[model samples]
Target: MVANRTRRLSVRNISVVILVLVVIYALVGFVGLPWWLERVLPERLEKHMGWQAEVGDIHVNPFVMSVEVLDLDAEDSDGEPVVAFDRFYTNLGVWRLVTGVVGLQNIELEEPYIRLDLLEDYSVNFARDWQANNPPAEDAPADDSDSAEPMRLQFDRFRVAGGELLFRDFSQEAQEDFRVTPLDLALNDLATWPREDSESNYYLLAAVGSQTIEWEGDLSIAPIYSRGFIKLGGVTHTTLQHFLKPYLPYQLRDGRVTLSTRYELQSADELFLTTSDGQLDIENLGLGLAGHDDELLTADRIRVGDISFGLNSRNVSTGTLDTDGVNLSLYRDADGAINLLEPFRNEADEEPADDSSDTDMPFRWTVAGVELGNSSVNWRDEQPRTGADLSLTDLSISVDELSDQLEEPVNYKADATLGGGGRVVINGQATPAPFTLEAGIAGSDIVLAQFGAYINEAANLDVRDGSLSVDGNLDLDQQQDPLTGTFSGAGEIASLDLRLGDSDERLIGWQTLRLEPIEYNVAPARLEIGTVTLAGPTVNVVRGGDGLH
Candidate 1:
């Protein structure tokens, strides 16, 4: 009878203990814990993160192992809001709580507005916050030490929807507003630990100005390595032109531009930028002086494709770049200035371009090849009375091994169809500093009338029935103390007739003229002649005018 009573009392006692424990758990998860945390979390977060943080209506759902915070607001010291969001939801794993560590499985945010501003002298508030949050690189010794370990944050996934971002640059005199609406970002399976099977991936989409940007790829957020493909759809050339009006020397009136890039990166003192394929396209682009309306140059189409490059500790390299459909006009104005290249000359007092190497940067680089195709160039000279037009069609350029700190020399080759039915071919090789070139110019027949402007510029003469040919080699070295160069060639001309610039009638004629092995050097301005031969030369004398002898 006593044994039976003991068993009954023990069962009743166990049931009472279980009921009390269940009540306590319910109160802590549903009301007590969330209320206490919401009251203190704002101040604690603000103090620890060095920013003002406010939280409203936090709810902890123990049954679902989840927490949701509604209406979170944060601001920086300058009273500018860092971020404002309608809702932030985080999912938790019960196993993590048992391990006494705060770990999140998924974090989702709704409708956040984030702003970034650039300040003067390259100082920015975003940079301060980034440095504050990131681990000190200086503290990590260069030597590999087991004792030192970087603190890593762990999270499974992160997502943001219906976001808006704004950026402003106040560093320069020209201030432009940049914004992206309906910005969305997502990442999944992110972790501090490196795992081969890690399916960490991300995607982003935003519209800034007229450009729509889309990015998708794999990423590792901690210890930072990422690979992504980006597509920038058709940016408006007019918008870019106005935005860049301040610093540019010429105005861009119209164009349609698109770009795409595939890249991989690794974060280190030495950056590794690995690109698989990249391309940029522009069509119907007009180039002109900044304030002038008349277009100085225009291109029907331009394409740069198949670009691949990488930079790392030892070297930098480019796979190949193909440039096509480049058409433009070059002109000399009445002031004897070539408009194509005149605007780029910088004054001596202005700051020079930056060529300083980062002491740790890789010194060697190679461009595997570059090709220019379907290029047509037109040059016109409008110097007072001399009106001349020159055209080069069927023009193509090729370069190979263009490199520094490499074993092979850089090679360049050009083939072009010249005006007056002439063809020119040139080939050269160099260490990229000092170079040598071999060239040839030949045609069965060339008209001197088409080269009238060159004659007037060189010898102040007008000519008819002119024919010219040259087979030459040249060597140049600008790296020398005073700059030295040499050119040697054999030249020939046939059926040439010339007259003084003031008179149109021919005064001199030659059936054939030849110069063999003529050489010249520029450091001391020396000329050496091997042989000069003239054939069937004739001169006509005018009675009342200046005549040829």
Candidate 2:
């Protein structure tokens, strides 16, 4: 009877111990772990990073070794949110620890936002003070043989969605601000240790202002190699104007650029980059003179197609370059200097030799073809006493091919209207290496009265109304000491009315005058005329007592 009573007491004691263990497991897994994650973790984070941290809720599943954090926020001393996230979820592979590897099934972040501020001294906001307070630790001598290898890390999947990054620069006077929002990124099967599975498939997409940037392909971190495609669309120049403001004399009023290319990068021995099958487009470009209201240039679009570039080879090639609706403005001030060239005037002083030239490889580039349509140039000359304005409209130019290392001549053609009264056309072939050009030029109905200022200054004569026509061929050779050119032409001047020094009376009048089979050379300054024909000519000369006019 005593033995039976002892046996019952032992069984009761075992039941009590099992019940207590169940209670402890329930409390820690369902309650205590969540509380520590939500409260203690944030406190420790704030203490280490000098930032206030807040977590809305945390959920932990001890059995699965998984964690989920919701509405986490970290703010700087100024109460500015430096980092925030809506949700973070990760699951650890606890069994993998036995194999000396840290493994995660998946890691995900949603609605993560980060703000970065750059100061005038080129320091970032969060790092400025922290780095100053905590200098890098001194390196200690160690024997490599005694060192233990770092633990390997692996993840089946990692993802970020609805991410935003804001970058503000106080270095510029204008305080440039840029933001990338709606950033979505994904990487699959990533591992720190080198293996056949180390090459991860990655994709990134983001919106930068109104633009969209995308990158996708395979990447390996251990060997540092990537092969992918990158596309940038509608990247506005206004967003990046701060980078050019310090170096350019003009203001970038407006523009957008787009580029798409396939790229490969390798960093095993030396860094190398290559891109192929690229296309670039620029649209609605406008440039204006600094501190002036006048626009220097404007273009509707420029496109380059079939581009290939290599960084290590220092080579660039494009199949075609095309442009449309371009306009250029030029002005000559009263001082006989062009306003558009004011910034470059009197720059005869030799420039300092660039040190980089000694270390840098020479670049080689080529363009298969070029086309420009609907372009115009407007020129205003205040040097003329009366101020003259001239316009070249309906201008179109074409080039067959051009390159820095061309052995054959490149063919080109151009056509335009001058001052709404004359038509000009030129066809040429040029070789850049030898610097030679052979061109055929033709012009008709060129009003001579438009050049009255130059005519009056050169010969003390005024031209009221006249028209000139010419057909010619010119060959130029820069190899010559004086940059000589040869011209063979036939020309005619018709309906010319000339006067002397503001006089009302006509000094000379001609119905038609012609010079045929003319040959001119610039170097030796020679002119040969085969025939001179005058249809009707009249001259009025008065011998005044004061002077002979």
Candidate 3:
């Protein structure tokens, strides 16, 4: 009986010990742990980062080994919001600890927001601020040992939903804003540990204004390789014009671009990137000169297809480029410089630092074909006369092949109608290196009245009303330093009326004046005229401004 009583006493003591342990666990996990975290986390973060951090609430679940932080806000020194999130949750997978891997069962972030600014010198605000606030520590003595092993980490699933990023650039004179809203990201089976299946899958979806962006990819970190498909749908020019402001003086008034590409990247001894099956389309593009109402360039559509590029080899190739209904306006100022090219001229004046090493690895690019249809160009020149305007309409151009290597022949053709009921055609095959061209040029009923300003500027004469027709074949070769070329052509001017520039007196008149055949050769430096025919011709002798005749 005494032994039984001693056993009962031992059992009672064990039960009391178990009850005390339960009470302690409940107090720490359910009551004290979250409060302690809420009080300490803000202080720790501010002390280390020099930024203000706020935590609304923290909850710990002992049963699932999970923790949740709600309503977290982090701000910069200037009280600008850097990062804020509504809810962040993570669950610990304790079993992975046996294999020296810190594993996360699941991690979720909801409604996270980030704000970033880029400065004029291309430095980002967050980085500059952080570096300024936290100076680097002094160098320590080097240890004669191998570096510490990298921590191994694994995540079964990670997700972000309803995220937003506000990006602003102060690089330009005015601030530019770009926002990505409702960004969703997901990743599965991501691990930094050695495993049979090391590849992770990821998907991203986001929108900027009306544009939608999507990316889905498979990545592996051990070997550092990734393959992905990316698409940008209906990105408008207004949303992206700020990116081009530095390079262009014009404003993008209207345009939308759609692009899709498949890409693969590998990081080994040298980084390499390969892209294929790319397509880009631009629709309804209109570019207007800054502070001007008229469009400088406009296009209905431009399409680029079958694009492929390799970064390691520095090669790029495209199958076809097609553009339709393009209209361009070009202007030349009194200084004999194109107004549209002023921006590029200014940029060129700021000479780039020479890098001779880059010359050894030149880029190789080629386009299989190019086609432009239903295009027009309006040219205005303000030299030696009140601005003369010339227009070429209903233009179509085609190039069969073009490449950086200039050894091969490129075949091209162009056809256009002049402003006043005339047509011009040119077809040619050209080699760019030694600069050789064999071509035929023809024009019919080109109006001479429209060329009065040029005639006055060159010869001090005015062309009132006339029609010109020409058919020519030219073979030009610049293989030698001096030009070696031959031109054979026949031309006719009919119903011609000309007058002196200083006075409204007729100087010359002609009807159906023709040169039957004309031939010129560079080798012998000679010109041969076959014949001249004139139906009616008249001329008047006029004294020049110098009073010679």
Candidate 4:
């Protein structure tokens, strides 16, 4: 009986002590702490941060080790909002308070509005604060070097909800005025201490002009690392033209461009972001040049597979790039200038130095391969009345090892059907510099009827009927200025007939014509023909007095 009575007293006394402690903590947190902070923090923040600040109400519950700051607002000197929040919340560990220190386990900024801007002179409103917080080595004190004793702040989880951000830049007044609004983001499981289970993850969504952008990914703080994906969707077509017009030298009359990209990032060093993997999709892109209604370039779809790039050090690599339903028109304008070359004429090519001592190379790109499907092209000249206009349809090309470095030969194989049911095959390997190439080109059943109109317009002549068959193999070298190349081919034109442009009367006819074993040299501008054969050739000489010959 005595032992049981003593046990009961001890339990009661322990419960009583806990109850008293809870009450005291409640008094301090719910009443005393809130009141004190509301009075002191608001006054001190404005003076210390050099900004206008306000705090509506503060709430603390030491029992739960939580704090809530409500209706906080801050503005810059220009009366623009630096930050405003409906509520700011934080979670603290109760046991940690015993050490007379505050450690935050989590923090949340709810319905926050943050505004950032850059002026014409490339100055930002928060430049000073940002520089102070992230100082360069030369500007920082020697003692606070990279190996210094690290500051300890336990912020594990951070979250933002119903947040909005506006970013603007006034750099290029005419074209560089940019803005994004109604930004929303969320971040969770950010830990300073090492965690083996998982990693920090985040998601951000925003609107830029008429486009919507979204990103979701993982991130870490110490030894900073990140791995995530970003997506951009719902971009309007006309918005692209308006934005691109100022950057290009040519006028863009009209175009329809839709872009959607999903990118994956895995940084080897955590600094170069582009050296990763991703996909790019562009749809219904059409570009037309000035002074004409003809399209310069058109494509139904362009997609890039796994991609990696690091322009900071000029290292880039990409997987297969596929383009579908593409149509390109290469034309010479009335001024005897090719439309394709005009764009590059205005672009200043970076001149290379003579040696490594004078130059820092900036290009080291590698592409695994490229594939084109169901494409077509038209090559024409407008300067000549009857210049050749050739069309290739159902075109496909497979290219491999296209790199800026000559370490590997670029290999390509292509096949295309002529407009009138003829087909051609081309296969080649070439080096970019100290140029060398070995190629084979073969075509069959190239009906001359396809060129009837071209000959009529260009040479004031007509093609009655003809077909061509060609087989060729060539080797070319541009390594030396003299430019050496050799080709062995035999081509035959059969059952050919010709007439004057405006008349259907036949002037000449041939049963067969062939050329074989041809060679060419650029330095001397000469053509070597091993043999030429003609059979059953006939011509009607219309004498001055002749009527219909």
Candidate 5:
């Protein structure tokens, strides 16, 4: 009976305690909690961020708070604008209000734009100003400060659908200058108070035209720093390297960058570029440079189907270059301009020497061919000391077509001379002139009647399948008024037939003529055949120099 009474009394006491606790929870949640929150929340946010904010239309059952901003702007103590947002609507997390934590569920901004002008010299100064005015709360200190305890602001997520951040004065004039237009940014998975007094680590994704860049990176809101090392492919701009410097490390300014595809370049193609492993020191910041350091403007190793030539250069002003395997060296003056070629001028070292008599100059020349080997001419004192061996190959000359309607044409094979002594060599078929005929003319027929009329008065003669063959001495004497020569041949003519063709009939027959001597006039184009006797059926006359009819 005692144990039952103790157990029943204990159960009755627990039921009374639970009923009081339930009543208290209901009063705070559905009735008075929202009223107290509306008065207390705005004060806390204004004291923390130094910005004016208003909360309207609070609901307690479903736990919702609608925040509306009439005007919002932040400036440095010097009154320079940092950021501004106007006419904003956002929904707050009701659970956060109950837990005494400030959190937003959804934030919708209507046409907000930010202007950021970061000059090279004033960046650090602006950072200092930002630190001083927005001092950390007593409970949370700023990250960049030296204090052991740091301030932090925590947030679940934040989204901005349409906005623009205009950055001006991002680079020096001579370095890599650029401008970014229409900036739209979105962040996800953001937690502001990541560590003690530290900024958030977020997943960032942004798009510029067709190119989308994404990275898992960390950003510190307190000290204002962010870094995302990522690969951006298919961005085809020759000046992209110059434009990406502000966001990248200083070392990448002169570092090696490997491009996947070759960029078509304008102007002269040859260029030498140095991009080895190096450090870039910009405004006292060190950065690592990586990628290819050679000529950045070449298609040398590109995978194009057919290999074509291209030019690449590092120093366009004064470096050597190669285009399609042709090597060329370029030079420039001190002013960084190309040095132009100068005109021919007399030099001080080439002044004329005092002299009267003409001095003998010595010259040596070598000539050789298949039949003649190693022929040389050494001229001393204007006279040729010549020993030349010359071989004549495929040398032939012939006159075809003797009709009045047609002009006689002479055709000859090309000849090459190799070996001989002296400056002249008499070889091959004998002609009335000093010129040599090739061996191909050995069996050609000769009509003396046509030749006699063209040269001088000569006897009627005929040679069938006969060739004029002569091996003789050639004398060239330019010291006299009229230069002359003699050509003698000892070849027989077969079936000799002679009758100068009249206007009536075409005289045609073969005749044998005796060997004769021909005299040639070197002054003018003339030839004189000596007296000849025809031996055949119409052996008409043995003439001194007359035609036989």
Candidate 6:
């Protein structure tokens, strides 16, 4: 009986050992199953989703498993290639693997390159093709209502360490149009849903070395929309401003832009803007008809203030110009060839009138408080070398060129105030080159010494409570070298005085020489004088070739 019992015990022990071995075999085989399973898993998925798939060698250990892709090139229904992955690997959860559960711990894609082509028609059918082959479910709606919910694509971590995205619009043929190059983009937060309807928006931050572009804000897939504010700080202010200028509604090729504000849209072909403070440094600006190649009018610096501007009928117009603090320097190259710098006090060149057969050209200028302290303009050829040291306050001048003889002579006027507390009024016709005058001298001493010197003569002059009126004509006739003209002056002298030449030829007396009763004329080479007409002059008159007579 003892022998039989011992044998029974051994048999029971053998049976228990066999059961333990079977369980161990099951566990070991299950844990190692993914090695064999992964080989065919990718094939099954490809067939199911209508994608071409290939797999690399699979690595398996008791605790971990990994599967890598040797190559993958799949196409959507549109036959557009999606992505090319150099190497892709996935790590399996060892705990789940031992229990027969199916899933991966994490998947990693290394250097996956993708190319997308967007058309101008705004149709994104490539995505539709991708979805068709890999349908989500029968209950899924046709429209992208789920897209509003947000899109999340996750991975252990995807790195585009070195890759490029080529996007092109094949429809454009014009060279002047905009084109986008292959931008190297390193993306993160791809797994997070991009906010569409939420008040808080989503963003993508990317960098290429020192240069960085942060594209933050809301994005909508439907209707194809995007709205965001861009703050560019990394690059130099000049370069950044230049790159941003093209996006502006107005062209600023030759201008110093201090600050600017702009708003734009896709559908609307118009742009609204407000400029804070800026100056345009342009040699010349042209404005004309759309197809007409010639420039209708031109100016030196076209300034728009802390100046508001608008584009209407293909012409740029200033809504409000703040000229109080703005200054524009203009240089003109006349003769269309001669290089010259003409700094005008003010200039405005408007478009030629459309209806009027003969274009009416008018120019206006204002030189407030012009201080000509010892300034001179010298002419070499028979032209007068003009020089003056006078201060003119509030000088305004306007000239209009007419085609036909008008009811009134071409309007010309220059108004200013002299430094001697006297108001100067000058009004004349534009045609004869406009003659002006200086008047209103009361209780001021008139110095006739310079006048006498210019005419090679001497005279004693005094004016008390008197009026000095001057009138002149300017002839622009080219026949005469110096352009002959006449200038006349008359003044009232309260006390009479007389003196001519030196002491030997001087005629000094108590005779009253009325200032108003005297007239003077200057021609090409002759100085003519009218009667002095004093009330009490019994003096004899003398004449010489070069002296006052």
RMSD each, Å: 6.7, 3.6, 3.4, 6.6, 26.6, 17.5
Model 2 deviation from the true structure expressed as Cα RMSD, one decimal place: 3.6
- TM-score-based ranking: 2, 3, 4, 1, 6, 5
lDDT of 5 by residue, 1-549 (tens): 999999999999999898888777666766677677666655654455343445553435433555455345554444555455554666667676565556666555644555565556647434545465478689884576665544332355565545555445544554332233233344543443434544444443444444344444456543344544333333333234456644533222222222221123222233322221111111111123244232211211111111112233311111111112111122333343321121112233586877654434322211111121222211112111211112222222222212221122223222222122111233333232333333321222333322333222333322222322333333333334565443333344555334443322224444466545555555575666666656653423343455633
Clashing pairs in 3: none
List of clashing residue pairs for candidate 2: none
lDDT computed for candidate 5: 0.39
TM-scores, all candidates, are 0.70, 0.90, 0.89, 0.72, 0.30, 0.31
Q: What is the per-residue lDDT of model 3 for residues 1-549, given as tens digits with 9 covering 90 to 100?
A: 999999999999999998898888877987799999998888876766667999999999876789999999998888889889999999999888898988999999999998988889999877787677678778956765558777888888999999999989888888878899989999998876446646798999999888999999987776577799999999989776878766667789999999999999988787889999999999999998766687889999999998999998889999889999999998888989886775567678687978666447898999989999999999889985745888999999999979998978899999999986679999999999989999999999999988777888888788888999999999999998688999899999999999877767777998988886989898869998899998888888967699976
Worst 10 residues of 1 by lDDT: 435-444
Candidate 1 lDDT by residue in tens digits, 1-549: 999999999999999999898888988999998898887877765655567878878998887788888888888776788788898899876676664545678899899888877776767666776566555677686776657654444567789899888877776777666788788988887766556767588899888767788999998755578998998877777557655766677778778788888999878565667775778787778788745566666666666666566655455555665666566678887778877666675554688889777676657666668887777788888884678898887788888756775435677788788765677777877664453343333344456677788777888788867777777777777666777778788888888898888887788989988889889898899999899899999787777755534
User: Quick one: best TM-score, which candidate?
Assistant: 2
Error in Å for residue 537 of model 1: 8.2
lDDT of 6 by residue, 101-141 (tens): 44455555555555555544544435534556676788876
Name the better of 2 and 4 by TM-score: 2
Which of candidates 3 and 6 is the stronger one according to lDDT?
Answer: 3
Answer with 1 or 4, whichever has the higher lDDT.
1
Clashes of 4: 3
What's the residue-level lDDT of 227 in candidate 4? 65
The global C-alpha lDDT for each of the candidates, from Candidate 1 onward, is 0.75, 0.87, 0.88, 0.74, 0.39, 0.39
Off by over 4 Å in 3: 1-23, 120-146, 194-196, 244-254, 287-295, 344-355, 358-362, 502-507, 522-525, 538-549
Q: Write the per-residue lDDT of candidate 4 for residues 205-317, one digit (tens) a residue.
A: 88766577787877766656666667666465455545566676555443433333343444346444553656667777677776778887788888786776664566777
User: Which residue ranges in model 5 land beyond 4 Å of their true spot?
Assistant: 1-66, 70-82, 86-102, 107-110, 122-154, 174-182, 192-212, 216-549
